[model samples]
Target: MPNLTEPKLISGNANRTLAKAVARRMSMHRGMSVGLVDARVERFNDQEIFVEVFENVRGEDMFIIQPTSNPANDNLMELLIISDALRRSSAARITAVIPYFGYARQDRRTKARTPITAKLVANMIAEAGIERILTMDLHAAQIQGFFDIPVDNLYASPIFSLDIMHNFRSQMDNLMIVSPDVGGVARARELAQRIGAPLAIVDKRREKPGEIAEMTVIGDVTGKTCIIVDDICDTAGTLCKAAEVLIGAGATEVHSYITHGVLSGPAVGRIQNSVMKSLVITDSIEATDAVKATSNIRIVPTAPMFAQAILNIWNGTSVSSLFDHETLTPIYEGMYSAA
Candidate 1:
């Protein structure tokens, strides 16, 4: 039997801010003494990750909110070690709430002599004693199959659609959702259909990673407000180039709403100099000062959304309602007050 009825959240160094936010959300509920598990994740002088669980977690459900974002290696290690400690301490179940799963891009090998790192990471997590996984907007949906445990991969469409409705309340008729590439059409199409907007595609050729050799627009974007939607934006090369293509095709302006902003290298500079009106990303990845300083880059808070999902999962309620735009208003709008 489980030690506790409610779940306890544990955070890692990868994104402590987000973990804190999740804790805060849980603290607001009534009859729910949900709070962070008393634990600490520190390091040795040799840069080794160490974790210690202070409080009794024996038979308690544990949720670790750690996104394997930048410095992914260290964060991944932290998660594995924390799970190991919890397992040893006799936690009932451990669910990894990794919003931005690192190495997800390496779900498969495009060339010979390359390893499928995503599969390997999944294996490592399973081996570390995690019972399940909860994540959002995985780069590839198929990555869920890599895990033998139950994986509840959430969608950001609910959050993204709400934001779009709020920001473009009046311009809904003129908006056109665009997939930066063919691979992202399904994601973009979901938003387009919800808001009753047209769909467009950016046909681009990638010779190698971080470089888009040639590009063209496949649908009519003329006189429309083009909004590019994608899962991951690492180098921002593809994002910036796709925005430029939309403008050349007579788009009124270009905007983007990517799930994970893994903005690396000159990504910030590229987005700033590009003709894009704005780039809206979720709080899945903590924004640095450069990202926060940009006038055109906006961050949508996912704390409320994630908090709701956590609540549902803990109660064994249906989280499927969170996948729809029409069904998830009160949660995102802060309807659940202090209880």
Candidate 2:
């Protein structure tokens, strides 16, 4: 049996705001003292990384919250070094909490000589002595198979669904959920089912990386408010193109709810000039100044969900139950009292 004691939460340089938010939520929801593990992560003159855990973590379950987002290599190295530090400190268990898993899009080979970097990253984490992984919606779910340890892939659908209900309840009758491509139809369908809306798909062809060749609307979107759904909005090319097509096809308004907002390379600029009314994304990746400056971009908090999952894992409960929004009552009702 695993230890039922409260786990030590550690935050990395990547997405510290989110880590702090999760710590706060855990303290409130679990009715116990929860705080970030004191650690000093710094860089040497040659740009090498150094990590030192100030507190004694012997026999303690440690959860390190780090998302490999912008400056991906630095953040990833931070996570690995932190895990190794915790392992050497005699920690009972270490869970790498990577909210936005970078390199996940490279899970497979597109060319004969292309490498599957996702698997390589997974191996690195496992080799670094991480016993488990907790991440949000991965670009490719199969990436979980790349790891030998237990992996819990949480979804942002529940958060998006609740936000939609609160913001668009009055306009539900004219709403439609849209997938930017065929691959994302399943994700779009799930959100559509949750909000009781019709579904649509945008057939898009990519001729090269980060470029959309042609896009076409597959279903009737006439006079409907379209909600475009996708896992990541990297450059905003697909999103802008999809929104343009939906508007051209007679949709009244267009909005988006994406899991990770990897807004890179003129993405904010493109969104500013696009037809999208708003782009709702989770705080999986730390928001940049450009993201904050964009009026149409909104960030939804994901710490509550992550905090609940950490509590469940610590208590040896089912983390998957967090997916069912209807059963989330117990999460707020002191579910960890027995622990």
Candidate 3:
């Protein structure tokens, strides 16, 4: 821990509930204080952004809590302005604590003359005087290399693995971990290994973004309960289609475990009509109204894990242990309530 005495926690409008949760977790220990700036960000008639931070925080160890989720442009600009304010006010060190790092999918330029927006976001953060970054479950692992500052890219797999072990333990023999796409095979494999289940993959060809033309099942899903795993679920296109494919392939049940639920467009409706029995998502990003209304969707909190990571980082301890399987068993156990 880096002298918790002088650290001042501040939050923007991105995810106040998560920020408060993190603050409460930090407050569990003595001698640390937290604050929030009146960061009311609004745009002019011409679409220009204006940000104002109402608190003064000079020469303090500042942590700005903001997630670049939906309305990414506004949230991102708010974060940048807050960072600039802290820097101008002479904060000793500034850390951008983003539970969900957006624009992560744009890590590479697949087409000619296209932009790598992920690197651009990193540049903006660095330019805003962010000394460090704390984020979770980046869409692409390579995005971490885009940042010059110390970037801690956390994983939500441990959180999900624990939840599955507790709720689906009795059905362990029938369970199969599925990668919704070939790109996420490693993530699916990790979860499969943790729960001692078989692994499968969904081979799909994309004619365009958010559209899956066709899917082929790579492994046996017949008469088995399948759990589709992925880094993020945007439109829920792949998940719904994959679930349908699994069901058609003799799967008895279909469920999804995704790290980030960037549920945009018709995702909620898609999941509602799909064959999926349930869709489990972590609260890396706040749940939208549509998500709340969808009966098939469930949300698990990541506050405990994130808070533990923050504690370990501040204490100058090993973060590797946080990623270890043994350390995460409790998270899933907690998911199962007392009967």
Q: How do all models score by TM-score?
A: 0.95, 0.96, 0.92
Candidate 2 local distance difference test against the native: 0.91
- Residues 7-63 of candidate 1 have per-residue lDDT tens digits of 789999888788888878777754455667778899899999989989998888889
**Reference-based lDDT, each prediction:** 0.87, 0.91, 0.84
User: Model 3 over residues 13-103: C-alpha lDDT tens digits?
Assistant: 7788888877776666434554455555667899777766666677777788889999898889989988887898888888898988989
User: Residue 93 in candidate 2 has what lDDT?
Assistant: 96
Q: What is the lDDT of residue 168 in candidate 2?
A: 86
Per-model RMSD to reference: 2.8, 3.6, 2.3
How many steric overlaps are in each model, in order?
1, 0, 5
Q: Model 3, which residues run further than 4 Å from truth?
A: 1-6, 29-49, 54-56, 329-339
Of the two candidates 1 and 2, the one with more favorable lDDT, higher being better, is 2
Candidate with maximal lDDT: 2
Model 2 lDDT-worst window of ten: 330-339
In candidate 1, which residue pairs clash?
30-339
